[model samples]
Target: MLLGMRDDEEMGRITLAQVAERAGVSISTVSKVLNGRQDVAAPTRVKVERLLEAHAYRRTTRSAREAPLIEIVFHELESIWAMELIRGVENVAKAHNAGVVLTESGTRHAPGPEWMEAMLQRRPLGVVLVFSTLPTEVKQQLRSRSIPFVIIDPAGDPDPDVPSVGSANWNGGLAATRHLIEHGHRRIGIVTGPEDMLCSRARLDGYRSAMTMAGLEVDPDLILFGDFHVEGGYDRATEMLSRPHPPTAIFAGSDLQALGVLEAARAHGLRVPQDLSVVGYDDVSIARWASPALTTVHQPLRRMAEEATQMLMRLRAEEPVSTRLELATSLIVRKSTASAPTGSPAGRGGARS
Candidate 1:
C-alpha cells in the first residue's frame, strides 16, 4: 500500500519519460502524442493525452542557446546553382553570428527518416531545406520542439502552412520564349525538367502562353521532358534535331542542359546562332563562360537563398513570416540566340513576315 501510494505520486508529478513509462510506450511515442502527430493511433493518443491532462504535465522549456546554429539541407550538392545558394546563406548567417551546418540527402530532394531523427536529436535553431519538402509529421515535431524551418525553391506546390521562397519561374519562361519569338523563330523547342516539378510545369506553361500570344502552333513533338542534367539535354536535343521538322531554336531548362544542347549542335556541325539558337534557364557562372555566352533567364538564386535565410532568422525570433516569397526573374540576352537561318521555319518559310 505504501509502494502504491509512492507510484501514484510519481505518476502525478510526471515527466515525459515517466509519462511514457506509465503509458506503456517509448519516450518518442510520448513526444508524438505531445506534438499532436497524426501517425499515432487515435486510442493511444487519447489515452496518453488524457493522462497528460490529468497529471497537469507541462513540458520543460529551455532558454535559447547562446550560440545557436542553423542547418541547411540540399537535394544535391553539385552545380554552380548549389554553390550560389550556399554562398548566399553563409553571407546572411555570418551577419547573425549563427553557425551553419550543411548536409546533402544524396540525389533525393527530400530528407530520409535517418536525417529527420538526427535533426530532431540535434535540435538546431532553424533549418533551411533547398528544393525540398517537409512531411507533416516532421513539421509537427519541429513545431513542438520550437525549431523553425524555411523551404527554398520547393520541389512542388508547398503546403499552405509551409513557408517557401522561390523565383517567378513562369515570368522567366515567358520572357525567354518571347525573346525567341521576337528573334523570328517559330520552330522553337523546349526541354523542361520532370513534369511533376512545379517550376518545370510553370515554365512550360509560360512557354505555351508566349507561343499562343504570338499565334504560333505549339507542336507536341517540339516539347521534350528532360532530367535537368547535361546528358539529358544532349540526348533530347539530338533526338529533336533528327526529327523530320526540327526546331530552329531551343530552350533548355537549365544552363547545364544548355551546355549539352550546345555540344549536341556542335556534333551535328551546326553553329550556335548561325544554324541553331539556344536559350537556358538559371544564369549560373558557366552561362557567361560558355564559348558563346549563354542567353538565359536569371533566377537570382543567391538572392533567393539570402531571403530565405533572413526569413528563417525572423521565424526563430518568434516573429511572423510570410508564407510565400517569390523573387523576380529577368532574361539576359547573350550571343547564343539569333535570327533563324535561311529555309528555317521563320526564315524562307516566311513565318517572320
Candidate 2:
C-alpha cells in the first residue's frame, strides 16, 4: 500500500505512486494534476488524467482548509432568468450553510478552460452549470477529483452522461399557443428562440402542434426564429406585422421578446387584444409590469435551480439520482391576450379548413 492511499471499494485500489509511475511523472506532478494546478505541462496533465481515469482513481480525502461552497456558472449573467436561477441556488446553499459562487464565462456550449482550472483549484462542494453541454475533458477532470456537477439546462438539451434539470419547454409552447387559439385567434404568429437551441425547437414544435390541433393553417411566413432577446423579438415582430395579411396574435418565446413585440405593436398603431393579441413565455418579473401585463408560460426557473442544487448534494453524497429531471410549466394569464379582432382575417369564426 502506498502512503496516504487506502483501499476504496467503489473507487478501486489505485495508488498515487502507481499512477505517477505509469504517466512518466513524479508523484508530486500527479498530485498537482489531481489538485488542478495549472503549472503542469499540458502533455503531462493529459497523461496523468488518462492514467487516473484508467485506474478509476477517486480522491476520498478532503482538505480541512477547503471552503464550503457551491459554484454556479453561466454563459450570460444578463439573462432575465439569471436572478431567478441564482435565487434558487442561493436558497439551497444557504440551507446547507455553504456559500454560493457565481461565475460568468464561456459560451452556450461549455465553460472556458480557465474557468475549469480555477474551479478545480477552488474545489467547491459541487457545481451547477447553466450550459447545455460540457466538454469530455471537463467531465473527466471533475470525476477524477470526485467533484459532482448538475446542469441547469433551460435549453432542454443536455449531454447524455451528465445529470440535468430542465422545464417542459414544449409544453410551455403548446400552452401559450393554445391559450391564443382558445381566445379565438386563428392567424397566430410565433417568435421562438434561436434555431440551434433544442429548447427553441421544442417550443416551436409545441406551437405547431397547437395550431394543427386547432385546425388552423400554419403560414410558414408567420413563424420566425429569434435570439431570445428584445432586439430579435422587435425585428421579427416588425417583419411579421408588415406582411399583407399579418397574424392576429403573436406568441413571443420569451418575456424579453414579448416586450419587443409590445413595442412593435405600438409602432404599428395596433391596440393589443383589441387589434392584435400577444403572448410571451417565461413569466419573468418584467412580464407582469409590461404595459398590458403579459400572458405567459411560467417556467419554474427558480425551482429548477433549487432542484439542480439539491441534485448536486445528492451526487456528493454518492446517492442515486435521476440522470434528467424535467419539471412542469404552467401558463399565467394577464391582460395582454384576448379574443381575436372581429374584423381580422381569422377572427372568431375563421377556423381553417
On TM-score, the candidate that comes out on top is 2
lDDT of 1 at 226: 91
> Which candidate has the highest lDDT of all?
2
lDDT of each: 0.80, 0.88
RMSD of each: 8.1, 4.1
TM-score of each: 0.81, 0.92
Cα error, candidate 2, residue 111 (Å)? 1.0
lDDT of 1 at 41: 90
> Model 2: which ten-residue window has the lowest total lDDT?
344-353
lDDT of 2 by residue, 94-173 (tens): 99999999999998788988888888889898899999889987787777677889999999889888999999999999
